[model samples]
Target: MTVRVRLFAGAAEAIGQDEVTLADVTTLGDLVARLVADFGSGVAPVLDRCSFLVDGVRAADAETRVTGTVDVLPPFAGG
Candidate 1:
């Protein structure tokens, strides 16, 4: 199945877009692997510090099952 991913912060800049469509991703981890492969090292650091949400709720694990729309949120820095 296909899923919609929304990228944020540095992750968005690395991928050059705010959203993307991923196909045949069985788990959240799989989707992340694909994204790393697609964007290469440019996105690696951010991916390492990222968190995920399915729909609107935080995903607890990379193995979490996902569908429809998800958000990939990279760590944000502030005081």
Candidate 2:
């Protein structure tokens, strides 16, 4: 299944886009690896502090299965 990922905050800047698609079911960590590879190590530090949401609800684990639309949310610095 293809999953859509929406990037937010520093992630969006690192990725240079707000959205992307993955071709199969992947863990959040796997997806992050891909993103870091594609974008650059500049995203790595931010990614370490990032969180994920699968279709809106927070994903508590990096091993969490992501099969559908997901959001890659980097740490936000503002109120």
RMSD list, candidates in order: 1.3, 1.5
CA lDDT, every prediction?
Answer: 0.89, 0.83
lDDT by residue (tens digit), candidate 2, 1-79: 6889998877888788989987755888788887778788888888788888987889988798787888888766778
Instruction: For residues 1-79, write the lDDT of model 1, one tens digit per residue.
Output: 8999999988899888999999999788898889989878678778778889998889889899989998999877898
Please tell me which predicted candidate would have the highest lDDT against the true structure: 1
Off by over 4 Å in 1: none
TM-score of 1: 0.90
* TM-score of candidate 2 versus the correct structure, residues matched by position: 0.85
